[model samples]
Target: MARLFGTDGVRGEANTAITAELALDLAVAAAHVLGEAGEFAGHRPVAVVGTDGRASGEFLSAAVVAGLASAGVDVLDAGVLPTPAVAFLTADLGADLGVVLSASHNPMPDNGIKFFARGGHKLPDDVEDAIEARMREPWTRPTGAGVGRVRRLEDGGERYVTHLLDVLPHRLDGLHVVVDAANGASSVVSPEAFRRAGARVEVIGASPDGLNINDGVGSTHLEPLRDAVLAHGADLGIAHDGDADRCLAVDHRGEVVDGDQILSVLALALRERGDLRGDTVVATVMSNLGMLRAMDEQGVTVRQTGVGDRYVLEDMLAGGYALGGEQSGHVILLDHATTGDGVLTGLMLAARVAQTGRPLAELAGVMTRLPQVLVNVRGVDKDAVETHERVQADLAAAVDELGSEGRVLLRKSGTEPIVRVMVEAVDQERAQAVADRLADSVRTHLSLTG
Candidate 1:
């Protein structure tokens, strides 16, 4: 699992684990894997390539484009765009595969590469495994005219914006909105889309120096957006991370609205508009218990998955559901996108406000979120923590103590040797106390002392 890809893609500090040479090798490998699988039809399979606004992306993109083009796959180079835009273009342009050079919300020095299969869907787990396995075997490269060619496409952004506007239900006239681009990929296009949708838009963190992305701004930290919204007396504010695949909102009053709130509001809105397929929402286990209560009241059933967006997307596709998301702002509105889409999510959320003529804060009030506290306990046998008897007993005892008001979860870190003890309760202190007790229990029983 740690070989070529991470939770998102092949990520590493620039020029370290990730390099021009490595990027080229990966692109060539991907072409063989995607092409050999019959991804291309009659014509040579084409690929859409794009990247976020990281300084490291310039070389990475060039390397990736060179690798793909030299491998007999035509390249549609859509430079400096959101990840979802690449996904949309792949599906919209009828390409065979799309490659996005981004580490998502990772830091400035860190970068990665991710791929979308035909129809703009993330590669399946088995496909990912196959690619990793193929990395070790000898690879073939085409020669001369048999090799693929790369072409620059200028209308990539315009075409994506047009598609977004076409899907919108209403214009955003009379709406004054502040957008925080996190100095990442959405710096240009996000503001453009909002303006075209008719919102009077003010931009913050839109000027990316390539090194400042997600620095004191973006969805990971929402204070900047909150201030901009209140300072400008804007109708609302939206924040996007490095890759611009997820969004978090700040209301007119400078109050922050998270993914759970957004999902609740959008679910009801979609239900009213007859667009919420199957009257269901797919969410990860990390979703607030408050969301469950809200859905229960609205008679909307929720199917829960693990924490990753890929897991949520997989569940949505399997269930044929139209909506899914994580608590961290990753959302998948499958009717409009096959993956988590910040632009699409922001568009739909803003459109709800526009069409309803209500404050986004009020519309987001469909649920009262319970206070959740997560304590990560390091220096423990994380894998054993889940099966340890004392830890299990502590979890069961905590649940029995809180009953309907609260519950406890002990989740092992996938990449690190740590245990995350989470507790949700009616109040903050209680949740923190329960989480502390669980962490202590895990340390006592699974501290690797043996």
Candidate 2:
């Protein structure tokens, strides 16, 4: 059978690729696997479940709750919370498992199920595979009182916000910030958290009718946030995705500050305060060469990992690094979270601005982002990109042409049959031209239909 879980989780179109039945079955299987694996041997297994503001999440969360409860695992339903909030609550409440119903930055018609093990860490691949294999297996069903119970977690959001505030290195006093919650999970809590942290907060994209989440707002689409920040004359803008696990920002001048700049600023701030662990930052290969150069010049080391936040987290845990993230803004401050927390990233950025009395653009000046272009060629044999003679030759030529001044990367999509061609240079035109050539090469040599 095909794997249900992708790099992130079991994400797909709601009521189609992902359905209530699948959610229920996954929950039951997760409970059984976690129980048999000794997570619940001494006590009744407990799970903390949450979802984004997608309409599908309503039924999906209910299905997950029913499945876990039927399997004798008590459920704490944290409704309409961010993914990281669910993770945090799971660990804070000492639950055996955590589940979040969200497709993250995906549009409203899609949804997903993400599982976290004890300690609120994302489950390893082996554990996820075990859960999948256990599905449809026969097992004795619990009856009456032996079945688990479910309850609403009334203080879940408050607890999460409190945790965020408690971990801040500096407060956001005197800062006027705009927050775009993507009309999803972070709508209520994000604004409240900022206000509590002392920022004069203006909110946009906070209204959710369920179907409109991520429509034209959020981190993925920064135009709304940039315009909002400019119109409101705010010091900065923070944009979170559907589930708020990651964030990207816009400066006062309406320039989008991406993950590379964010990571660089935080790393420098931590280093200055003598809090940087090992003076190292872990990042994915997608991180810009300029960020790496900045870290190098600052006498800090950069550890590169694969594309996913999980891969970045694994490296951080292995090396005891204090910071890591992707270019897409999934940042993990190891001291604060086991996974990425968009709100936390935003707070740290804003606090840094307030502390230095520097504009966000100045703080982000810690790294100069290289002109980068990415071209995605779909309907291709992604596997062939690695070995196709023409594609490899084209990539090598691009690299040779750019030499030390630029970089080129061709990566295969883990979940889809697509090849991503990326090029970075000192000039935007060169980057785009190189990316187009590589993409054309990939299309020619690796066309799936051919």
Candidate 3:
């Protein structure tokens, strides 16, 4: 059978691939698989359940809560919180597991269920496979008082915010900051956390009414945030994705700073403070060449991984690295979070600005981002693109043209019929022209005839 779970979790359009029944069954199965050890002495293993602001999440959350409780697990219903909050509560509240109902940065009509183990860490592949296997078995219905109970886990999110404030290396006093919440999970917690740390705060995309998540806002769309920062004469801006697992920022002049830059800045900061583990930051291959150059100048090492933050985190943990993230804004500070955390990343970035008394734009001068362009080539046998001599030649020529001043990347999408063609150079026009040339080569060499 085909797998329901993806690299991150089981995600799809609401009420379709991710139905309520599936959520229920998966929740019950997880309770059984993760709670089999007489967890909490058979006291009904506690589970933390939360969701983003998606309207579909309302029913999904209830369905998940019901399944776990029916399977004899107590439910800490942490309603409308970020994915990290669920993980944090799962560990802090001593729950057996955590389930977050979100699709991360995906559109509102899309949703998903991502799980965290007792310590707030992502489940290993073996465990996820086990849960998938168990999902096909007969459902267990605990009878009598053995059935679990459900209760709202209020005030728990505040604790997470407090933790974010407590861990800051310096306060953000006198710095005016703008926060774009993406009208998703971090709407409440992120703004409150930033304000508490003493920053003069302005908020955009905070008024989520479910359907508005990731709609022309958040990390994926930075115009509103940039405008807000400029309008308020703010020191900078931070934008959280749908589930607040990641953030990208804008400096005072409304220039965007992605996760690569954030990691670059943070790695240097931590290294100076003697906290950076091995003086390294783990990032995906998608990171810009400018980041690499910046780190190289600082004597910091850049470790490359595949696209996902999970892969980056795996390498970080394996190598005892403290900082890792992706170009798409998922920044994970292993010292503070078990998962990617927009709030934590934002606070830390703000703290750096405060500590140095330098504007975010000045600090961002640590890296000069090369203009890069990504073009999607579709309707081809993507697997053959790399080995085809014509395509390889195109890539080689583009690389040669780029020389030391640029880079090129051709990546096949994991779940789509598309190959992403990316080129970066000293200028945007050169990057776009090179990318267009490569994309044309891919089409000519690999285009499908229907």
Candidate 4:
């Protein structure tokens, strides 16, 4: 069977691939695995649990709570909070584990379960594997007083907001900001955070009836945020995913400011304050080449990782780097958060605008985003993308043709029989042309049907 966990966690359409039974089983396995690893040694174990406002999450959260409690782990049920809030509460309350019931930016029918270990850190692959292995294994059940207890953590959101405020470098007093919460978990806390930080906040996509998340809003959809920012004549806008673990923004002119630009701005700000460790920021291989160039010119180094933010976080933790994120706006400020916090990222971006007396557009202008085109070619032998002679030959020719002025990357999809052909150039036309040529080559050479 395939691994249950994806790059983030176990995710699927609710009630089907990710059912209440699976959530319960995974929670029990996780508790057992952690306990066996001595995470709960010398004391009773505790877990912090939260959920995005998904209807399916209502039952899944209950199942998870039941599983953990049955395993003799105390549960602090933080109802309807962002994933980052759960992580923060896990650490703040000295819990041994944290569980977040969310599928992040996925459509409303999809949901997932992700866990955090002690100190609010994402579990390493080995630990996740161990938990998966232990699932469905027969084990003795706790009874009587040995069964754990569950308590409602009514102040989770307030605690998280206070933490965000305390770490803010500067207040957003004079800024007019628009916040789009994706009608998900951040609906309340995101706007509240910006307001308390002193920005005049206007909100859209904040009304969650549990079925509207990621429905034409959030980071994946930028049109709503752009329209709102322009309509409000705001200094800028912030957009968060379903669980609010990722943040993307819009500038005053309704131009989308992506993660690369956000990272460049924050990198400079942190460098000036001597907070950028080793003067390096961690980014994925998918980051725009323009960002790399800008960092190089500014005397800051960028360490590249695989496509996932987890890989970026791994590199940051290993090198002790203070900043890292993906192009999707999953910015991780190591000094302040163990994982990506959309609310924190947005507040910090606004703070930079407030402090520098520069518009977000001006600050983001530190880098010029090269036009990038990606073509996903399916019905191919994705595993042979690298070894196939014709594909490699075509890729080489494209690279040689672009030389120092461009880049080409061919990556196979992890979950599907598709190969992604990505090309970046100084101009959109050239980028698209190169990408198309490579994708055609991949389809012709690696076609399984052929």
Off by over 4 Å in 2: 415-417
Which digits, one per residue and each the tens of the lDDT, describe model 2 over residues 360-418? 99989888889999998998888778888888888889999999999999999765557
Off by over 4 Å in 3: 36-43, 377-405, 414-418, 440-449
- Residue-level lDDT tens digits of model 1 in 1-450: 344564576777888978998888878888878777877656887999999989999999999898888888889999989999999999999998899988888788888889899899988877877777766357666788888888897999898889889999888999999999999999988999999999999999899988898888999889989988989999999999999999999999998899989999889988998988889999988889999999999999888998778899998998889899988899999888888889878988999999999999899888988999989898888768767887898899999989999867779854335788889999999999899988898888887874
Where is the poorest 10-residue window by lDDT in model 4?
A: 412-421
* lDDT of candidate model 4 versus the reference: 0.94
- Candidate 1 off by > 4 Å: 1-4, 378-385, 388-390, 413-418, 441-450
For all predicted structures, in order, the TM-scores are 0.94, 0.97, 0.93, 0.96
TM-score between model 4 and native = 0.96
Could you say which candidate leads in lDDT? 4
CA lDDT for candidate 2: 0.93
Question: Against the true structure, whose TM-score is highest?
Answer: 2
Please tell me which model should have the higher TM-score, number 2 or number 3: 2
Q: How far is candidate 4 from the true structure (C-alpha RMSD, Å)?
A: 1.7
